[model samples]
Target: MKKYNCIWVLLCCLACVGTTSCSDKKSSADEQEKGVTTVLPDTKNEVTTQILKKRTFAHELVSNGKVNARSKADLRFETGEVIARIYVKNGDRVHKGQKLAELDKFRLEQKLSQAEDALLKA
Candidate 1:
């Protein structure tokens, strides 16, 4: 009885393997047939082609945004003196130790004289 049971299980396993192999071959054949079928574009559709030519193309961009500088500096005078003249305008490029504006020389001289007098008095 045990031998018969073992034989029965072996037969069932063999049948399953055979069916699986046959299905695999059928699927491969179907794939081959599908691969051989070429899909052509619609003949009714129209396509226009232009000859290649060398030409310069210019691209212009128009945008609106706030631009921030990579580096910024806050300019100020050591003494509270009026500005007499400005040499450069806003958004102008500057270098180190460059004079951007001049102080009122008349007022500065007056202040200097006053300080000298006060020092003498003291």
Candidate 2:
């Protein structure tokens, strides 16, 4: 039984090696053929040719009015409580609806207990 397991493992290993070798050989042959046809553009005279003539490099420096979000928010908490987390810092870009910050959940737990107690009393 041990001999049979050894044979099976060896055969599996050989099969994997055979497949990888065959694929490597095939890809290498393809790449060799592709390399022969891959022509690199001549860059030797490009810079010299451009410098032999006068050229005007014009760039637009436009002072445009504000292009901004349709609406903006200065997010603030209505009640002052210790913040548990701040996921974003100033100058960090965020997608809409991303969790930017979180209030201390321990603070909310007290409010939850109070509400539950009031419900039980009623």
Summarize candidate 1's per-residue lDDT along 1-122 as a digit string, tens digits.
Answer: 99999999999999999997777467778888987967897778679999999898888999999988788778899988889999998888888888899988998888889999999999
Best prediction by lDDT: 1
**Tens digits of per-residue lDDT for model 2, 1-122:** 99999999999999999997777467768888876866787776544333466779798897969666656679998778888899998667799889999888887899999999999999
- Find the candidate with the highest TM-score and give its number: 1
Count of residue pairs whose backbone atoms collide, per candidate:
0, 0
Please give the CA lDDT of all the candidate structures.
Answer: 0.89, 0.84
Number of clashing pairs, model 2?
0
Model 1: residue 84 alpha-carbon error in angstroms: 0.9
Tell me model 1's lDDT, rounded to 2 decimals. Answer: 0.89
